[model samples]
Target: MSTPSKAKRKLRDGVADIASLWNSVVENHKGENPALQQRNLGMISRVLGILPHLVALMFTAYIVWIARPGSSLFSWHPTLMCLAFMVFMLEAVLLFSPISSVLRGAGYTTKRQWHWMLQACAVAAALTGFAVITTNKYMAEKQHYTSWHGLLGLIVCCAVNLSVAGGVSVMYPAIVFNMPVMLLKRLHAIFGTVVFLGGMVTMWLGLCSTWFTNNVHHDAVLALCFACPVIVLLYVMVQVGQKIFRRRAH
Candidate 1:
């Protein structure tokens, strides 16, 4: 056989071996209690749950380091926006995590309190960031919402506020007597997910901005930075989707 052919065959064999090993491991757990069967998967999920906090903190710090908040009025825009969506909003959603919430030991009421508190912080930071950017643009005599990032950001801000209002209705269903509490909760989750997705997209667009392109010179580093939020998004969606599905099943 040719050298290249041998290398290809070896790679295929390696992949097959790994797949076979994984299948065997899964088979070993067959007939076990459902929770017992999911022990390894749960461990992985717990680790994934913890990763968003670290990634958000690191990504926010990187943006702040580049933007250098307090250097000027414009500086605070990126810093505050990143903190609002990446840290506060992310944590607000994760507070309800069944397996890995930092407050998993706490009662549902406690989790609900913290969730809204973090969301309020996110809203405040987001609105303040928006105001800072508007003022910065006004002082510079620049056009507003010209770029995709700015336009989408405006929509995200509006949607976030609306979602928060929905959350209030969910929290106090008596406020909206027409809708059932269960229906209100479902609507809030759906709307909140959309807003969160918009915020992530806005962040991704910000990474593609001239400022980020110029500041982050290394291509590999920029790609890794882009992957961070995407990873968080996937984990969050999976967690949220499972809950929604389970609730529907019940």
Candidate 2:
């Protein structure tokens, strides 16, 4: 073969190898949980796990108390969406970490089952919430996908669906769905985080919506709504990055 042709062939192979990175995350799965790190992780886990639920609860309370939204079916949209995105999805992310030895086989794999189940609920609720909002918009003769909230929500919804699909796909035996295990793991981690953060952003946008702002115009409440989930999310990100991802200290 010509030198240039050989070089081109080598380049193509290198690109493919880079696309399919090694699955080092699995190697980190086995370890003794240092009493100290486990104790610290336990507290962080509690905080990370609880804050999203707190945000969802407060939002639900706001919907019920201040909004007192009439029997209109549209009232279900925010509450259900918040429950699914902020609560269930957050639980799934914080609970089902791939690289965390503390999470694996906890309770004879009860955690894995709960993780799967929570995501299933999140997907169902998100779809139903989307349908409800769309129907409400049409019933009121308002335009669809016209606002920033709608656009961002739609993108996050798609991300949620894709994340769910990827999660499911990777659950089967390797022979059943032939794909690179490492690639699937990376995709799942990256996409799951996207869905988590994107869902929060979408909810924040929802809070910023004129419809919501007009009803509960308290700046303090808005700050609360933003602060709760974000604080937890930042903690999770920083902790996960330090522990899971390859770091200089490692």
Candidate 3:
């Protein structure tokens, strides 16, 4: 072959190699984003999330089983109360489906935002449950039984929410999910931190600070329970933030 023709042939081969390499990179990227690869609650968390509802259902049945006209559970009010509790558990099942879908369908940005929204919703839902139970118990003059059952139910709710958070963190590493999920997670993390610290401070004020009163004991235990969620929120935020910042620095 002529010298000039040989040089042209070499250049053509080099271009083909580069094109092949680029195509491989693109294929790998697509592979990573497959629908089946979506972050989801692992098997254990799904089981734990359902466990409380099952236990609650059994306990409700037991209450119904043991009740007589004169017994606490047989009264019209307690029957209604137990029914409401069951309905709330059913509501949780309905809500969890959408929550799981959002977590799965969402890109990084949406996931982060959705996660924050979910957490906020969980906290609000918890508070709402507490308020409803407390007010109803006070009005019904069934504070003792109502308080115990309501507290147990709230604790179960918190456990499930916390487990969901854990599943998200474990299944989706903060760095990889960061770009697809984006800055929303960072913003949510910061906001969650602030919300948590503020909640803790407020609870302290209401329970042990100057705002506390003789009757505060009724609310004190519940207020203290709020600390766990606050701590979990802070920890997740810090770990996720660190992963994000490290990636950015790289």
Whole-model lDDT per candidate: 0.90, 0.71, 0.45
- For model 2, what is the C-alpha lDDT against the true structure? 0.71
Which regions of candidate 3 are displaced past 4 Å? 1-121, 124-181, 209-234
Q: What is the per-residue lDDT of model 3 for residues 1-94, given as tens digits with 9 covering 90 to 100?
A: 9998998899899999999998996677566644434433354456544544454455445334433324532233333333333333232222
lDDT of 3: 0.45
lDDT of 1 by residue, 201-232 (tens): 99999899888899998977899889988977
Rank ordering of all candidates by TM-score, starting from the highest: 1, 2, 3
Residue-level error in angstroms, candidate 1, position 180 = 1.0
Please name the candidate that would achieve the greatest TM-score relative to the true structure: 1
Collision pairs in model 2: none
Pairs that clash in candidate 1 = none
**Model 1 weakest 10-residue run by lDDT:** 29-38
Candidates ranked by lDDT:
1, 2, 3
Model 2 off-target regions past 4 Å?
Answer: 1-56, 67-70, 97-108, 173-178, 239-250
Provide the TM-score for each candidate, comma-separated.
0.84, 0.69, 0.28
Candidate 2 lDDT by residue in tens digits, 50-134:
5545665676577656544456788778877877876677666666554432365577368767888989999998988899899
Determine the C-alpha RMSD for candidate 2 after optimal superposition of all C-alphas.
Answer: 16.5
